[model samples]
Target: MAMTLSTPPVPADWTRHTPFSDPGRHAELLEDVAPSPEAIGPVVRNLLAHYRAEGVNMPVSSRDDINLRWVEEMLSVDQERHPGRSLQDPRATEARLQGCCRDHTLLSVSILRGQGIPARSRVGFADYFVPGWHSDHVVAELHDGERWRRFDPEVAPESGLLPDPWDLEVGPGAPFTTAAEAYRALRAGELDAASYGVAPDHELSGDAFVLTEVFWELAHRYGDELLLWDGWGAIPAPEEEMSEDLLALLDEVAEQLIAADAGDKDAEQALHALYVRDDRLHPGERVLRFSPLGDGPVAVDLRRGEDAVTRPGIP
Candidate 1:
């Protein structure tokens, strides 16, 4: 007999706040700017007109360009004003007008959660823009009572940036691959790891990037919001060095991520517990900031509370 599976219940506050998704940090950064996740995209669309994306249109003049870890860091202007500001709230980020895809995604997650919506960030590869390649990317997802809906705040129609804005009304036809899907594809050999990251010239590919994202996505669902480079398990190792055992582990990790993406509370708890003891993976009340710049990514530090460690005394 075919049995029916039930979806578990997730708390409304599960995705609410971490130092990573603190919307109050937005208002704390700019009193005039309401830290509304709903309003963040419009603000980003407007802000990008002036603030160039670091490493893309703009050059990394200082670590500030790369070190802006949290969503709020995008708000501050100039290195002299806020150097090494680890996390920038939306208001502050808007003020500065600089950020990468991760910053845009974090801001959206923060704003949405502050509005009392269950939202979280997803790390994966996007195939929507450059047909042949899956670019390393991040996006936001919210539970609309019945099912989880994906939202690419960076590609919102208001920005007119992405060639194809994912239509929430129509459901998930977007260009990005969730960490779970990437893991599955790689494991099945349906997709090669070399084609996984940005362009062929980019460094990532093989199992390392896809598996790292799966691990990252698992942590994000359980509210850890780990930094991009907080490697454990198989993260820092080269793909050629990965073993069969590691591949099997990645398969399990992918399952958990897929479950979390589908809003499985049981899987969420399982992943949380799995990473609970890994000091590097489980920041608990702390957040590790990852800055993807230069040949190797930089690690900021572990921070506690919602306040930006990089910019204290602002509030």
Candidate 2:
């Protein structure tokens, strides 16, 4: 009932890009890069800098609002920031695109796929960032022929969080815990919900945040790869009250995710079936984006490129 899974073989779809990870016109930027994390991690680090960490002191105007959800948009911003610089070159902290863990994972995935490698992003809580605090995070996983390997492109060698940040071992005692694993742990009274969330000091730490993250993990697994703040369907708003029924549904979801991740063929099929049938599990055409930059909640049309409709009073 821990909802943990062993590493499984890579899916063919993961070798390709989803709408969020696709580099579009800038796909050329990722070309010629080696598929291994050793080669790709540095490129990702150079192209984008963490808004809160490396670029924290950046001007208010430049920070926060620039969490480019799409890799194409991120690449566009990078080009505008530093023209003619190759992806391998070091970008000035100011020139790097401002984003969080998800951006790092997505860009890394895009680059890997471009090099014909099977890669995907994982949404979970990383306990390595702060002692006793599990912050919501995203990491990339690539299939190196035999099995899947998880890595944190956002973590640099200087951080000293892991022996090698490019390759990470996840699960029980490991630094990272998938949302499904955390959910199962919470239900079993093995873990405290309050300890898992956005940050140690942020107000968004609780059971509800963990529940939303279960859906976040599923979405990423199924190729949606949405931004950390994007919410749709069954994903609850911070103010919304959760009913007993919704919690039950999430319990079932966590179970399926765990089994599927372990390469249970039947569980994989069932999980996909559940995602397709449940609007609560997968996003629709539009989603409510809760911007961390204080832009307020707005309805984003997935079909419309970068056009966010300001729907007043949509909590």
Candidate 3:
């Protein structure tokens, strides 16, 4: 499952951003931290200390969106020192000091790229956390010219929620999963998409939960991290809305994803091309806002390629 296969050279593009992972946007925040390219491990550790998950003691008003840049969220430990920063600016993330899983992963990916290491954040299920359910999560994947390594900078031993323990150099699962894996398993009826969630009572997970994340991860693999509020083509569309064409497309993506993980560069490129070709996944952009738990509707910006444009959280 957690086999370490040798890797080929990642295309240079992975070393930079695809709109979402842009580090240059917040150069000052990442300046001296991981100044050198080889300091990836230290960068991961630094972030783990800097962030606390959204639900843990953090107010709901402060923690909803996953689209934030690293600068503001990372530096919140001392905002008084760094005043007058925009919430969207990456520089402010450092001052804000906390975020959800994607935030941590993005910060790591952004910092790693700043150091010139080919890295990207991946979305999928993390099995090591909750038993029986594969909680939707994200982690950073870095290719150091020789092999691709996965790191989870979010949950550390002190996080208290990590009972199974996480291997920063390897990520979760005996064989960690991506959107493709979840798609194949769902299609095969091996696993229920609704079964995957942060917790059983959480409203975010539903019948189409896994499918939605599949498209999100697909978008990320293709160089963009379709925001948490983003909708991808017909992915989270209603059951009646899922066309035969989309199902066929999912099959193709699943196949390529398997090959991509197996060291097939061609397959990897095809996946990115397919994503770009379907511009449906790259809908313009959604400028939304985040609200806390008790602060009314929270105005959740849920886009399922569907009409309902609100969510309680990342579903």
lDDT of each: 0.56, 0.77, 0.55
Q: What residue runs in model 1 are displaced by over 4 Å at the alpha carbon? A: 1-8, 23-25, 28-38, 48-63, 76-96, 156-174, 230-234, 277-292, 295-299, 305-315
Kindly report which residue stretches of model 3 are placed more than 4 angstroms away from their true locations once superposed.
1-12, 35-56, 59-98, 158-175, 237-241, 285-315
Candidate 1 C-alpha lDDT tens digits along 135-166: 77777776665666666767766555455354
Instruction: Put the candidates in TM-score order, highest first.
Output: 2, 1, 3
Off by over 4 Å in 2: 1-12, 304-315
Worst window of 10 by summed lDDT in candidate 2? 306-315
lDDT of 3 at 201: 73
Candidate 2 or 3, higher TM-score?
2
Candidate 3 per-residue lDDT, tens place, 170-243, comes to: 32245347877777778888877666865677766755677666666766665555445444456453344456
Candidate 3 lDDT at 96 equals 46
Please tell me which predicted candidate would have the highest lDDT against the true structure: 2
Sorted on lDDT, best first, the list reads: 2, 1, 3
Local accuracy of candidate 2 as per-residue lDDT tens digits, 1-315: 111233344232676667777788898778856667777778888877777776655666667535567788888877877776779877777767778889888888888877667778888899888889999999999877666789998887787987888778865697888999998988888888888888776779887788778888888887788878888887777888777888999899899888877768787777767776787788877788888788858887766356332221011
By TM-score, who's the top model here? 2
Report the C-alpha displacement of residue 312, candidate 3, in angstroms: 28
Between candidates 1 and 2, name the one with more favorable lDDT.
Answer: 2
